[model samples]
Target chain A: MKVKPLADRVLIEPNPAEEKTAGGLFIPDTAKEKPLAGKVIAVGPGTSDVKMEVKVGDQVLYGKYAGTEITIDGKDLLIMKQGDILAII
Target chain B: MKVKPLADRVLIEPNPAEEKTAGGLFIPDTAKEKPLAGKVIAVGPGTSDVKMEVKVGDQVLYGKYAGTEITIDGKDLLIMKQGDILAII
Candidate 1:
């Protein structure tokens, strides 16, 4: 399924947080941290006049706490307003 | 310390998630969910022609995972681009 956000919203597919520690030991799900990286899949039109700094296919580093999670085609995607984005990676 | 975001960014102070369950029992910190709410403390200039829909002191509902966390005056706050906000409450 495909979803598009309106206005200044974006659709992102979160990159999973590392599952292994530096020692190469697998971390349990309960102990794993949330992922803070994702790829921009879709972006809304430029904010009125300011052109969007990010574009689809840009790999971005977002705050771990950014964006709303939505299920699309059984995959988790984030729908966040543009202001929530810290920077375009 | 006060921090003001630039451009379309916003500075927010997160509201803590509930520490207790419906049964009124305290949930362990390890199991606590991230908060999805915050209060807008500062906002950047409007996104070009789009006047800001939010303002300082407005309580907002965001995605559980939005915004970058920053420490200001020993308090944790979020700095996210405006698009990450789902709605203003």
Candidate 2:
């Protein structure tokens, strides 16, 4: 099923937490930091005052605990407001 | 010292954590959630591509983990990029 967001909301697929460091040493789950980046899957139309700046397929960084998590058709997703997004990278 | 942010940056004074519940029960620090709102103390002249919409003295809500924390003159503050801010309230 496809997910659509209401005004000023966005749907994202978060990047996985780092499993290893740059040196390729494996890192334990408990030592991993929360992922703060994701790919935009869908975007809302936006309210008149807050125009949408991100689009589908855009990679973005956000607050570590910004969005609500959900699973749809076995895919993990995050639904957040446009304001929760930090930057399009 | 006064703070002046670089392009698209903002300085904020976060709202205090909730210390008591509506029922007047004291809540411990561990149980308190991070403050997601603040008062803008300064704003940067935005980059040409991303115009700043928030102004000094505006009340805003931001992603809970959006900024870097610092203490100046014994006052705790947060410094964040414009992208980290969610909305003016």
Please tell me which predicted candidate would have the highest lDDT against the true structure: 2
Model 2 lDDT tens row, B35-81 = 37789988866765689999989988887677765444457677788
What lDDT score is found at residue A57 in candidate 2?
Answer: 92
**Candidate 1 stretches greater than 4 Å from native:** A1-89, B19-35
Docking class for model 2 is incorrect
lDDT of 1 by residue, B1-89 (tens): 66768888889888765521212443443332322656899999966655566689876656556788899988989988776775553
Window of ten residues with lowest summed lDDT in model 2 chain B: B18-27
- Residue-level lDDT of model 2, residues A45-73, one tens digit each, is 88765567778998765666788998999
lDDT for model 2 = 0.71
**Per-model lDDT:** 0.66, 0.71
Model 2 clashing residue pairs (backbone): none
